[model samples]
Target: MRFEIMNAGKIQLCASLCMWLGIVTWTGNMKLHIWSVFVQQSYEGDVVFSVLNEQVNVSKGLRDGKTFSIRSPVTRKNAIEHRVFWSAWLDSLSTRVFGVEHERAWRKQVRDARVVVLEAGCGRPTNRLATFSDGTRACVRYGIDADQVLGETLSYYLAELLGISNLPPLALSKLNLSSEQWASVRGHIEALEWSPNAIVSLTEFIPNVTGVFIPLHLRKQQGGLQLSPETVSNMTVTYLVELMQWSDLIIFDYLTANFDRIVSHIFSLQWDARVMERTTNNLLKTINGHLLFIDNEAGIVHGYRVLDLWERYHRLLLGSSCIFRRSTVRRISEMKRSGDSAKLLCELYRAREPLARELGSLSQEHALTLQNRIDVVYKHIQQCTDIM
Candidate 1:
């Protein structure tokens, strides 16, 4: 599996090159503020939004921001754990795939998921949750987390919204099930004091969310040996070799959980695979069969968000972690000899002239960051190129 996945080659900062060539542009400075009514009254929260350019106070709980209503998604009091989790997942893939380019695209993917949706690894519905109108086709929100505590909160939240007490009853009719599958499902139903068939049937979940916020954190923890970062002084290579195997199962679960609806109307699912490093960047499924893979790690790293990584780096990296050495150059080079993706990534990284000219003309902070990025990525490209 690692060999097949590696065949796709290590994608380089070519996302940088692509950006320079007008395919995508890197963004380091972008305002992200949608202060919600819920965030205002919290004990630990402060409310501030630009009402006029005067930046007035908003204490009355104005609901003019982006939300379905004052009461749609489940509300949780303490929500930072999940927010950090989602950001971590995004950080890992963002730097590697679309380095220096996916700043906006990543959020856009989740925001634009207008059809079938799944918020995998949803700790709490804290950041940028989706919204749909009444006529919207089964815009069912499915959030799955491995943590029972989190799941308990999420299930309760959903039940309150759906007007029931226990686990969500299937909101559709005609569940698709083979004999064995049905028997297994029946057993689960009987054991739990819950009935997924009451409001809707199992069949209606088709084209629906299998597990909306399915948490792959469990898989990551179980697969710890494979995803561990091996360090040698400064060079850190997160050995994400074994995670490819679970990609299909993850998608299958997503599909099964949402199998309640067939999605006649346009249903968009923001498949946020924050965990499972290797597979998170993989193009697992597509909207109506259109393959979509969003790699925005580069943007995160260059944006100075690595402060988060740097803080927790010791926890994730082995002590043997050494400063990235010249020897590490061969690691990338060996790939370029046989891997197309590596070559593409390297070329993108090396396209300094176009990048500096295109992106250099932006704000001072952005220009400085892009220049710093080009220098680092180029060093890697140059070190590896001579090896092959």
Candidate 2:
């Protein structure tokens, strides 16, 4: 028995040493290959060397049983090449999935048209299903507080700026009973006890939207959403379209720190282990296979305020996938480089909304936080690109 124990100990030590040597050899070869590619392709050597250093550290960590901070679905040698193709495919997609011109017209209509009716049937009691004089319908969110309205409105613009057309077109309105837009709904507004001059937001009411389920790949216990040529080739066109939108969804949520959707499900995993099987909150799918991100009232303002408690879950969701849309990454990179994300967002909001002064804007502190979050997301994407 003593001899057997000694032999087992020796075997374990030898196995560990072999693993370490294998990792070192692999790292050295990967560095050399990357360096050669940089030289041959005329790519910046400094960036290539930095990425190589990171890869070496990651290899060392793996050998020591340490997990990577950002996880990738593709772990094969051709992952970087696969990622390039995937990003190009995403970038090649039309940015007008929701019809940018139509959305602009819809916003104008929603903002200018008269509100003919207000009913209590648009998901929540505070949100009214409204009819405009032009016979168009909208969901009017009479935010419980100013922050909620600000969050929803600004989040929409942020998505727009990022070239993500998932959120419906939004316009701001005030609860003035004397205004031509709200005069017809005065009785209903008064009955609801809404204060005069309270700012609210109106979103285009999408018909025939169904709840979206978390994809099996994202719900897996091990890792989330692998991106590779082999994996993508097996996917049906519809699945691919939805996954493409989902990639944007993840990035948007991470930047906004919006925990009311996937992050909430992750948080629920502590108690309801099967929570991921359910439909995602605030996510809806059109019959044509486009995803609509709804109820963004929790995104920027409230989401940032509660970041202290929810940031880990936010990071967990953000770090799950290595793939992202190319256009989205470009926008993020630009914002990070310019350091004007918050300023740009605010300017867009104020310019578009006529009652911007009444509604107010993001505080200086929150604006700074928003910029910082953008920087963090940019860095994470850079790290992901390097690893891939």
Candidate 3:
């Protein structure tokens, strides 16, 4: 299976190159020197095209009065920057949806509101759909083990720190029979045998969200999603927006080492070769096309503990992505430069979660591991830039 996947990736890479060459030829500005270099590189087993190669073709296209379908030159750097600019412009023209302030308000509401009812069937059997006194709903996750709750809470905050807003606002709650918040659901909690003082996480429930499948380009038998000039030029606006979010998702999962979403499917490929064709687990898309990253119980704590078995798959997924959000990259760069990523994360988790002490903080070892992963990601970004 591994060999087959590798072979498929190579074939897809070659096909992408062929498609790019066709585009260049069609534009009627194909240069002899560029063709010669491409041939030489192909002979040397260096199939990845450099950003400069793309720039030359785009410049030639413009000089020859050839117009591109997309607004920007679809080179790696330019395409990514243009998409980022578009996203920012769209935000400026309208009230920012799911912006920082909106998330902050949602968090406050979920944290302070009283839980008026708890019923089964949010996503998992163990989780409950909670109705608050204010008529808002949240998905209450009752962790069979404490680590699940911890992972969910910490991962949400980590995403927040990285400026990734795809994750819904999350808050921690303690089960207390005497508290008014649990008064209506006290018997329900007892029926489930939840501990009185246990801490669980409540994520703001998103309505009318549809399941999201892994993008076709990222599937097992294709060359992973590449921001090559031809590829981006052919993409629709909706595709560009989703791809932008996906780039952030890859970075987030990599940093958290979350294996439940993409990695698990990759692992399953060994047994079920068609697994990647299915909708990804714990991922959903809103009616308006915003992705909601849910069910992060496998992030941080459990993910780190089992890293030895899954790190290779995690690295594979991370390596397959190149384009990224500028704001996310900036935050990562700042964290990498300051060398205080661990401290900053710890402070955020401790300050925001009142039950943090009771639930326990991330261990020094895990904190160090988190810092190391951040450093690795920063270096990966540098490597991507170097290729550009």
Q: Which numbered prediction scores highest in TM-score against the true structure?
A: 2
- Per-residue lDDT of model 3, residues 320-385, tens digit only: 777676678889998888786868877898898888889876888888888889999999888777
On residues 159-182, what C-alpha lDDT tens digit does candidate 2 reach at each position?
988989888888898787898999
Q: What is the C-alpha RMSD of each candidate to the true structure, in Å?
A: 26.3, 17.2, 13.6
Worst 10 residues of 3 by lDDT: 32-41
Model 1 TM-score relative to the real fold: 0.21
Per-structure clash totals for the candidates: 57, 0, 0
TM-score of 2: 0.77
lDDT of each: 0.24, 0.72, 0.72
Can you give the lDDT of residue 154 in candidate 2?
85
Question: Where in model 2 is the C-alpha error above 4 Å?
Answer: 1-87, 90-95
Pitting candidate 1 against candidate 2, the one with the higher lDDT is 2
Query: Which ranking of candidates, highest TM-score first?
Result: 2, 3, 1
